[model samples]
Target: MNARSLTLRNVNKSYDGVHMAADDVSLDIKAGEFVSFLGPSGSGKTTTLMMIAGFQHPTSGEIRLGERAIDNLPPHKRNIGMVFQNYALFPHMTIADNVAFPLRMRGVSKPEKERRSREALAKVGLQGFEKRIPSELSGGQQQRVALARALVFEPDIILLDEPLGALDKALREHMQVELKRIHKDLGVTMVYVTHDQTEAMTMSDRIAVFNQGRIEQIGTPDEIYFAPKTRFVASFIGDSNIIEASALGDGRFETAVGVVEARATGAERNSRADLLLRPEMIRIADAAQPDRRPFKIDTTINYGDNLLVIGKLGTQAIRMRVPGVDARRLTGSSECHVTWRSEDIHVIA
Candidate 1:
């Protein structure tokens, strides 16, 4: 199958003629790549997905599928497959018929439709459940059927809008793996939209983080987590402690805790900046170098795999994640020093 690229150029959508739902959003989704749109509600990810699916028209700018400008095309004419959070299956129809619906609508013959429907079902591990109705299947099974339906017509691209939101946590996690496997096997260009950070982190080749109708950053999972471009992207993608500080030049910053070293390549001296600290990067002072500063340990929470220690660092509350073994060694210590390498401190512009 030939996968086609999707492009949005300066796309903007506004309701009530003033506020923009998607502001100057430009993205190029490469053919056969899995990219995820991750953000909170009303962040314009869904609106952007709708525009790509031809369900919502952009107020201005261009949308192209491969070489053709598709901004004016109807949803049906675009030939894109879409999966919704609600499954959107025909409850009255058998699983086979539902999977064959798209092919039927395109005037496929009965024999070919049946063959393709069964083939799609087999892809989703639902080959034997074809005769059953949507009501007779479990949530995960129904979701698989929905995926089968979306893929039955062999679309050039597939758009999934929170397709796993309705399932339970364990089942949702299971489906994440399934989706990754399916994407790998089919090599179809897919654009997934979800509010779940873990889902995006686990399944996407790259992630586009959205905030307030604009894309804050777009990068690989590690880049988005360890090197966020903006404060919003840092706080949204994972747990982060953002500290306000003034740059002291020479890759250093002055904070309440003390003067700390950080990566501030482009930041000017004496300018205001924010430092991003991931809890896991900070180590207990005892386990690290002895020169690190000591802080009063206020409390600790046990998470089985790791211990989350919350404490005060020069009047500012901070958090550190210690490995279980290291946490056990400091069980009775009220004051423990914590330290992180200069490279671990991300100075957000």
Candidate 2:
């Protein structure tokens, strides 16, 4: 199979001139890479996927698969495989027939079609269930059958629009691993669309975060988690304590909690900024470490696997996550000291 690189340039879409779906979006995807478009509902991720799959035409700009322009090409002529939120399987056909449908449409020989169908089912760990109808299979099994059908065509790229949306949490997590393995083994370009952050973080090589019909940031999981570019990105990706602070001219911040040392970059000195601190960065102060900042623990919550310690400093309350193993040590009243290093602070103006 020939793997193709996809590129979108200044792609825009709108419906009824009131809903601006995608706004001036441009992205480049490498061959044999798994990329996900991730965002909440109405963020234009699905619209962008539809445009790339040739199901919906962009209002402007162009789409290129390698050197060939595919903006005007029909959906079938694009040679792309697609899996939707719904399985969309034929209830009347067995799993084998469903997988072989694509090959038959392309006029492959009956023997070759059967061979490919069985091989595709085996690839998805559904080898012996090909004789069962869609109605006879579980939700997860039906979803796997749809995936097998998509792969049986041997398309250059596959578009998956929340393909695991219907499964339970545990099953969806398992399928994420399966999809990653399949992508690596097949070496086919895959563009996945999902609003679930955990699923995107677990499966994608890189993710493009969408908001308000625009892409806010595109990076690996760590980059997006630790080095968010905007305030929106910082707040949306994970839980963070965003506190307003004043840059005290020399890598120091005057915050509501207290004056603390922090790292500052790409922002002017003495400017107003927001400090983002993850819950795990703060730690309880030790008496042996006398130089650590002091804090007063206000509340402690047992979260099964970890203890969430809420503390008060001046008028502000901060949260810290402590391991369950160490939770037994914090059995005292609401009065514990806490501290954090200077490097854990993320400053966004």
Candidate 3:
């Protein structure tokens, strides 16, 4: 596939002409890259994707495919494949015919259509399930048919808007791996929109985090997960313990618990800041250790492999995750000590 870069410049969409559904968004997606638009509902991720697909026009700004502007183009004219949440397969047609529909629309001959349709199905790991109707296939199989249809035309890019949302949890996870393998093999530029952070983290090369009609941050999964720019991004991406504190300089902060040692990112001395600590980063330690806080164990949840310890440090509630073996050590004890490395704490100014 000859993948081409997609660019959105200052895209804006306003429903009432007063409130923007997409607010001054500008993003550049590299060719052959897999990027996910991740956020909650009404966060403008789906809206931005619609604009790119020409289903919705941007209120203002340019939507470009490589060097050509496509903001004014119709969805069909844009040569971009789209897979909706519902899969949108034809109930009356067989699976092969459904996959061949795009080629048929493009006026391809019958022989060529049949060859390409089966090839697309094989690409999605559905080689022999061609004669069956949509209703006969499982939800996961139907989704693969939709994806095959999208890729049958060999468009420069494919847009998937929560295409796996209908599947069960186990199937959804299995499809995530399948989709990643397909993308890697085809090298097609893919823009996926979903509210599932775990999906985005596992599948995307870089994540564009959307909130309130704008992109809050765009970075690799590690960067977004570990060093979030805003408190919202920090809290939204994963399990985070947000601690309100005041900067004490020299990589320290004064909180309700005590003066904690943490690497201050952008907090000025004597100013208010928020510290983000991931549950897995904190560990059980001796009470006499430096940077340690006395934790009153309130509750514990065991997940077989790992356990979550919810407790309090002074008046604030904190959570820590430890391995199952470590959880054994905390058994029969209501109190313990928790400490984290300075680098593990992310300071949000």
lDDT of each: 0.92, 0.88, 0.93
- TM-score of each prediction: 0.97, 0.94, 0.98
Query: Each prediction's Cα RMSD?
Result: 1.3, 1.8, 1.2
- lDDT for 257 (candidate 1): 83
Stretches off by above 4 angstroms in model 2 are 294-300
Clash counts for all predictions: 1, 0, 0
Cα lDDT of model 3 by residue, 6-123, tens digit: 9999999998999999999999999999999999999999999999999898889999999989999998899999999899999999999999998999999999999999999999
Model 2 weakest 10-residue run by lDDT: 260-269
Regions more than 4 Å wrong, model 1: none
Per-residue lDDT of candidate 1, residues 1-349 (tens digit): 4589999999999987999999999999999999999999999999999999999999998999999998999999997999999999999999999999999999999999999999999999999997999999999999999999999998889999999999999999999999999999999999999999999999999999998899999999999999999989988888888899988889989998889898746778899988999999988765558558887988999998899889888887888888998988669878977788999999887
Candidate 1 lDDT score at position 301 = 93
Better of 1 and 2 by lDDT: 1
Worst 10 residues of 1 by lDDT: 282-291
Whole-model alpha-carbon lDDT for candidate 3 = 0.93
Ranking by lDDT: 3, 1, 2
Positional deviation of 344 in candidate 3, in angstroms? 0.5
Looking at candidate 2, what is the lDDT of residue 194? 96
User: Residue 273 CA error for candidate 2 (Å)?
Assistant: 1.8
